[model samples]
Target: MKENEVNAKIKAAQINNALGFFILSFGIIILFAMIFTETFIEHMTDMVAGLLLMTIGGGMMWKAKINIHKLKLNKTNDNK
Candidate 1:
C-alpha cells in the first residue's frame, strides 16, 4: 500500500479504538448506575443492552488493534 493509504488506515484504526473505549466507558457507567440505583431495577433489559454494547465495543477495539499491528508489520516488511 502507498504511504498515504497506510497512514490513513492507521488513523482510522486509532479512531475506532478510541470510539470503542468511549462506548465501553459508558457501558461501565451504566452498569454501575444500575447496581447503585433502585430505580434502575425495573430496567434490566437496558442494563443487558449496555453490557452488549460493552462487548461490541471491546471487539471493535481488539479488531482495530490487530489491524494496526498487521499494517505496521507490512510497512516494516516493505521497508526491508
Candidate 2:
C-alpha cells in the first residue's frame, strides 16, 4: 500500500479498537452502578443501552478489518 493509505489503515484500526474497548468498559460500568444503585428498572435500561453501545463498537471494528483487508489486497495487486 502507499504510505498514506498504510497510515490511514493503521489509524482506522487503532480508532476502531479503542472505540470497541470503550464501549465494553462502559457496559461494565453500567452493570457495576446497577449493582450499587438498587434501581432495578434503571439498571435493566442501562444494560440494554450498554449492549447497543457495544454493538456499534463491534461494527466499527468490523469495518476497520474490512478496510485493512481491502488495502492489503490492493497492495498485492499493485505489486503484480
lDDT of model 1 at residue 8? 97
- The residue-by-residue lDDT of candidate 1 on 7-34, one tens digit each, is 8999999999999999888888776767
Residue 6 local lDDT, model 2: 75
lDDT of 2 by residue, 26-47 (tens): 7667756665656778878877
Model 1 TM-score? 0.88
TM-score of 2: 0.68
Please tell me which predicted candidate would have the highest TM-score against the true structure.
1
Choose the strongest candidate by lDDT. Answer: 1
Which stretches of candidate 2 lie above 4 Å from their native place? 1-3, 6-10
